[model samples]
Target: MLTSLYVRHFAVVEEAEIGFGPGMTVVSGETGAGKSLLVDALLLLSGARADSGMVRAGCERAELAAEFDLSALPEAREWLRQEALDEDETCRLRRVIRSEGSSRAWINGRPASLAQLGELAGRLIEIHGQHEHQALLSRSHQLALLDAYAGHAELVQRVRRLAQEGRALETQIRALQGEEDHASHLALRRHELTELERWALAPDALAELEARQRRLANAGRLAEGIAHLGELLDGEGELALRRTLARAQGELTRLVALDARLEPWRELIDGAAIAVDEAADALRRYLDEVDLDPARLAEAEEHLARLHELARRHRRPVDELGERANELRTELEALEQALAGLDARLAERDRLRRDYALAAAELGASRRAAAARLAADVSALMAELGMPGGRFEVMLETHGEDTSLDLLGRERCEFLVSANPGQPPRPLRKVASGGELARISLAIEVATLGKDSVGTMVFDEVDSGIGGAVAEVVGQKLRALGSRRQVLCVTHLPQVAAQGHTHLKVSKENVGGQTRTVITRLDEAGRAEELARMLGGLEITAETRAHARQMLERAQAD
Candidate 1:
């Protein structure tokens, strides 16, 4: 339920904050008083398009905000939770349009895109008018409404799932016959798998083999390096650390006998000499093992080349050759198995097709039954809403020749209508006048009460061409609808305004040479005065006031 609306600098309305309660709220005023501005403000808050034209004159931007109580709207609450926009049990929608034609929106005080705002607003409100967002203008919405009436949700879901599965199977069958069935492709795949199997590659085999190859390639360089290291450590060279360290240790030992303070220096030189000898011995052993073998080097090079060629052929790096081989092997095995079970796969596909056909048939049957009821109910309501002898039909056209799968069942739906007797029903969109469309839309909405999940419904002058007794009937229907869900009606008929649980009168006033719109909520006495004005027009008489009072009393009694 929408709880409040605040509008600032919107069109001719400078500022207005209107509070609404649940049930029927009637907005009425004289012609050209901007009664529809309230509805427009709600639409903007519901994510309708905004432009500089909506901004008030002398104002930089127009701001509109609405608050909805979600306590009774579990679906809305859950939606907020899913979108991470929940603010307790309330939902706030705000929109701003600048004079430069820039527009922005926010949901729950968090910046939101137009799409998000529209999505949330769709679930929150449904506006019926000559505009595009009206659900009655959409054939898909008609079909959905009929399906909801028939409780076909589960059946429809099953059919949709079956159709999706059929599409996936069709794709797989095409691949099997088109791409994977080629003899040349299969032969190449087989050869690759055989080569990989023969090599039996391991994850780290390439790295290990390459390291061994490097060692064999540089065997001579390694031997020379080892020999030079040994010469530097102990050979008969001036830089031989072992020979020099031995001479230094002998001199230090003689000095220590002369001066006991040099004993520590002698010990340090002896340790250095021993360490050099040990290093030279280790180097000699390493040189002995550095033997060059061309056979081994060639073998490592050939193995590394084989790995590289396979990697390039498979469009992978040498390090990932093992993983690629495993993947190819798995795919080849699966393809071979699939070929063996080709007949079985075909049989399974046939079974799935049969299942899908069965589900679609069930769904179609339910829809046809529901369509009958919907047509009957809407036609009956149309007669009461001033469309006497009007006929409404829910036409279901089946696609019997369609062989391909579709998620929306195997039929199309159209809402056909005829406003006069002896005329065949035509598509609802073909109806010429806006008045007839509004009435038809009203009948459908009234008949489908509790079928829609939207919390609020707005009717923009739907009673335009209606008055007298028919206007009274329209008011009763709206009141009944309001009893079920929140309803806001912009009406000029006194009868409709009298039926509202709450009434607001829109009036235009000039202030400082500027025309501005204002909305005033009417109390009991105020309601009677407004109703009198509506009934008597520009003149208010004592008799008109008495009649207005009687009308309100009678309406309340009902």
Candidate 2:
């Protein structure tokens, strides 16, 4: 239930705080008194779009806040707790709109996104706008209303889940078959896989083969270079580097015995001779191992060339050939598996379709039963709400009976209404007048009241174009609804105003130099006067006051 609303610098209202109670609260005001502005502020707190124009002319921003008691709204409280926005047992929704058209929202004083505010608002309040009859005309909302009234929410959810599961399976099977349908495309991949398999490729094998080929190709030149190097270093030749270094070292050692500086030169000559001898030994071993075999070299070259050709054919680098081979093999294995399982997948799809069909049939039957009960119940309430000869019906249109699967089952639900005895039932939108539409909407809501999670219901001018005894009945119905849940109705009818447990009057006046709208809760005497004003128009005569007091007495007696 809404506890209070605080508004500041919004539209024509400078500042006002209105308090509300549990049962029916009716807001009534003269024309052009900005009563709708209060509704607009509530809408903003409920995540409606903010308009810069709503800000007062002298103010930079407009601020609106609403407090709701969550004791009876467990779902809303749970939402607040989950979002970490709870504040004891109350939920505070605040919205601020800047003159520049930007806006911000807060839930229980915690910053919130507009979507979060919207979600919480939806769970907490159900606003039946003056134009809400348009929603009654919507097929989806009509179906929802019937389902809600018949307690078919759980069953509908089950059917939706089954349908979703079936669709997922069908999509998977289609994707696999889509791949299988391109058999010709898979043919090239098959050839690539076969070529890679024929070589038995490994990542390092190609490089190793290339290295061997290089060694074989240069074998003769390598042997000659090593022999010549050996001769220069230590072989029996006049220019032997090791022999010359040894003689130099012996002379330097003898000189070092005479002078210390000669010792450093002796060390240098000795190191040079040692390095030359090591090189000559290594060269001799290499010369002995070197082999010039044309046949082995040709075979290595041919193997490397074949690997390179495969790389080119696959448009891959030579080193990546082995990796490419593995990828091709994996893909080909998957395709083979898919082909093998095609028949099994088809069988499974058929099974899933059958499952879906069974669930949908059950759901349809439940809806049919629920629809009948819903039409009967709403039609029964219609007469009391001011539509005496009205009839309500639920028309179900079925589709996809011959197809494989469907999402919202096979039926489409629409609401049909006959407002007069001689006329046939037509779509609700086409047959009901504005006043009749509001009454029908009221009946439907009353039928499905407790089934809805929303704790607070707002009716904006629902009594429009209605008066006299019908208005009194509307007031009674609203008061009854309010007994179970919070109801806020905006009306100009004194009958409805007289029924409120709490009455608020909206009025406009010139304050200081500015025109401002103000709302005040009225006492019993004040309520009588307000109702008298509503009844007598321009002047409240003694008889009008007496009638207003008697009306209140009669309403209380009922």
Candidate 3:
């Protein structure tokens, strides 16, 4: 239930903090006095789109806040708990709209996205605008309302899910059946796989092959260079490294005999002579092992050329040839599997269709049962709302077996009505008058009350085309609904205003050369004066005041 609403710098409303109670609250004001501003504020708090024009003329932003009691709304409380936004048994929703057309929302003082605000607000309040009844002319809207009244959310959702699954299966079957040349495609893939497998494309094998090719290509240069190195290190010439070291060793050994410090130099020359002999031995082994055959070199070069040609033919880098081969093998495998499973998929599609049919039939039966009860209840309400001899019917047009299935099940729903006696019922859009439409819309809402879990319901002048006894009946129905859930109504009829458990009057005034809207909760005396004003227009006669008081007293007594 809504506890209070605070609005500041919103349109003509400079500032207003209005307290609300548990029952139906009616707001009344003269035309152009901004009576609907309260409803607008609630809409904004409920995550409606905001506009810069909603800000007061000289203000930079508009602020709107609504507080709700969650003790009776466990669903809303649980939602808050899930979102980590709960604060005790109360929920506060605040929205700020800047003059630049940007808006921000908060839930329980924590920043929130507009979608989060909308989701939480939907569980807390349901708002019906003045033009809501106009939607009744649409068959789709009528179907939705019927479903809502029937509480068929779960059943309808299940039927929709089954139908979607069946459609998806059909699409897959069609795609597989369309591939008529799978045999040829598979053969081509197999040929490509064979070609890729013929090459040594694995990373390790390719590295070893390239290394062998490099060694074969440079064998002659390597053998010649090593031989020259061997000659430089240990040849029999006088300038050879080993020969030069031998002479140095002899001279150093003689000098060492003369002075012991010379012995370390003689040892260094001997170590150098040994290193040169080892170098010469290694070169001799390398020259013997090196492959200097022209035939092997040609073979290595021709093999590398073949690998490059394979890379070019496949339009892939040499390194990626292995990956390409794997991809082709996988595709060939999948194509073969798809060809073999075509019959199985077709069978599955048939199974889904059968399942969808059964579920749709069950949903249809539920709708038929709910439609009868809803039509009876709405018809009874029509008579009480002054449409004597009126009848309402929910017509279900079942589709044929050949018709394609959709999310709306196998039947279309439409509302039919007869507003006068001795007349056959016709479609609501074609037969009902404006006043009749409004009353019928109200009857549907009244019939569907308590079906929704929302704690509060707001009607923004839904009583537009109604008056007199019918207006009073509308007010009574709304008031009765308030007994079960909180209701807020914006109305111009005294009959409706008098039926409120609480009354609020909206009035516009000019202060300091600026226009502002004010809302005040009405006491018994204040309610009488406001009702009298609504009843008598610009002049409030003594008789009108008495009549207004009596109406208020009578409505409350009822």
Maximum-TM-score candidate: 1
For model 1, residues 18-60, the per-residue Cα lDDT tens digits are 9999989999998999988988888887777888999999899
Question: Among these predicted structures, which one has the highest lDDT?
Answer: 1
Better-scoring candidate (TM-score), 1 or 2:
1
The candidate 1 region of ten consecutive residues with least summed lDDT is 198-207
Greater lDDT among 1 and 2 belongs to: 1
**Candidate 3 Cα errors over 4 Å, as ranges:** 1-6, 15-23, 42-50, 64-96, 102-126, 131-141, 151-158, 182-344, 365-403, 414-439, 450-456, 483-486, 509-512, 521-529, 536-550
Per-residue lDDT of model 3, residues 1-558, tens digit only: 999999999999999999898989999998999998988888888777889999998789999999999999988999999999999999999999999999999999999998899889878887765433244567876777778787878888887887788788777777777776777777888888887888746888888889988999999889889988887888867788888888898889889989999777788788888888898898899899999888988887887787788789888888888998998888888778877888988887777777778888888898899999999998999888778888999999987574355788888888988877888989877753555666676677788774667788877776776688888998999898888889899999999898899999999998999989989888999999998898896778999999999999999999
CA error at residue 211 for candidate 2, angstroms: 9.1
What lDDT does each candidate get? 0.86, 0.82, 0.85
The weakest ten consecutive residues by lDDT in model 3 span 128-137
Query: Candidate 2: lDDT over CA atoms?
Result: 0.82
